[model samples]
Target: MIQKLRQSGTLLGFVLILLFFALKLPDTFLTARNLINISQQLSMLAVVAATMTIVMVMNDFDLSVGSMASLSGIVAAMIFTAGYPVWVGLSAGLLVGVLGGLFNGFLVSVVGILPFVATLGTLTVFSGMAFLLSDGKTIFGRDIPTSFSGFARSGIEIGDIKIPMLTITAGLVIFICWCILEHTNFGRRLYAIGGNKEASHLAGIKVVRLRLIAFSLTGLGAAGAGLMYAARVASANPTQGSGLMLDAIAAVFLGMTMSRRGEPKVIYTLVGVLILGVLDNGMTQLRVDSYVREILVGLIVLAAVSVSSLSKRRQS
Candidate 1:
């Protein structure tokens, strides 16, 4: 019973947040259209959070996600601006993500550098690359192909609500990640490694290979999010994804609080994403200042991590 309540507490908090907003802005927040709008807005963050969960599950971190995303979008947008096919640009962006992730993994698993230091260095490198690729300007207007920009804008309509393609794509990515983390042998190995890396290595688990793969997936997700963001706005800026890494990490940490083992889960991460999304939307409607919103979110993240640590101590 205690465990159940603990697990449900985050969900309850989410419900309370929703109810609070609904009561305060009954004409807007409680409406289905507004709820769907929130989902659409959070779609890109959700994609990043999905893979971030996997990275955290392995007890690893990827601070370079935001920079990698910016680089990917710049790469794709530049290609489109130069009159290349959409597929060509997309392939180049994804390749950058994969190769970038591999570089981070290589530094951590092969060169014995810590994940934090390696990713921080790479984050700076990738951010610089993004500016270099885009010449420190936003790519917009007729330079971006209509076909490419239409990808995120197109969607299925159900009555009054139109489900965005970006949201659907995010959902699919989240489902795939959930399956990989919850139902696959690879996932089991990750948990084993996280629980005890030395024992996992003794048990013949390829720790280095798994870590590389985990980081690769994270990069891929970040790249995909970048592409979607670029598509949604029909433009790509060097700093467009500069804030994604912090938000994604915060969502993962918040979700970890809901886990019985204090580990990250994709579904819970989605809930965390929703909580942040709703908070942003609600506060915006209530005319809260942006700086105040940031401070509140930071406080919430700190509280969530403290709660998670306290729960793990109790279990131990």
Candidate 2:
């Protein structure tokens, strides 16, 4: 009973929070349109959080995710500005993410730097690089091809229902991450490494290679988010992705506590992301102080981390 309750707590809270908001603002909060918008808003965070799970599984942080997203957006925007095909620009952005992750991998796996320190350095570098690319200005959507912007906003639409590209992208990434984590040897090795690095190494696991791949996926995921953001707003700014880093990381930890073993899982992370999105929408309707979002998110992170640590200690 205790285990079941514990596992379901986060999800239960999710539903209750929605109910509270719906009760408080019947017309605004309970509307299907509002709910869909909230989901769309958190889609980018979901993508980043999905990959963040992989990094956490190997016991690492990708602080550079925010900047990585910014860099990816800048890359795509610049390509469009130069009149290149939007596909080319997007592909370039994804490649940049991979390269950035590989570099981080080299630093940690080859140069033996701590994951936090390595990603922090890259975060600063990527942030600066983004500004340098755009001259610290927003790359306006009007400057990009109409087709690009249109496709960004285009998705399946059926009468009163619409599914956004960003949502689809996030779903695809989450599905892929879940498959890789749950069904592959690579995923099993990640769990083994996170559970016991020395033992995995002793057992002949290529801990370095596997971890490098994990970090690389973080970069790729961040890039996907950046592209979505840039497309949605039809603009790219160096600072666009900064605030999302903590949120994505927070959701990843939140997800860890949703499982019996405190393992990082994608579905739980989506729930965490949805919690944030719903809170933001609900609070906005209530005219709450914008700062409250930060406070509540901080509290959520703190609680999630504490729960995860406790779960791990009990399991041990």
Return the top candidate by TM-score: 1
> Each prediction's TM-score against the native?
0.96, 0.94
Give one digit per residue, the lDDT tens place, for model 2 in 1-316: 5566567767777788888998999988888788778878998899999999888888888899999999999999999899888889989999999999888888888788999999999999999999999999999857767777776678788797898877787889999999999899999999999899899999999988988899899899999898888888778888898877998988877777788777888788888888888888888889888898779867866775675575556656
| Per-residue lDDT of candidate 1, residues 1-316 (tens digit) | 6566667777887898888888999899988878778888999999999988887887889999999999999999999888899999999998888888888888887887888999999999999999998899999999889898998888899997889888899999999999999999998888888888899999999999998898888889989888888898899999998889999999988898898787788999999998899999999999999999989878877876776576666766
Candidate 2: segments with Cα more than 4 A from true spot: 307-316
> Candidate 2: worst 10 consecutive residues by lDDT?
307-316
What RMSD value applies to candidate 1? 1.3
Candidate 2 lands at a TM-score of 0.94
In candidate 2, list every pair of residues with a backbone clash. none
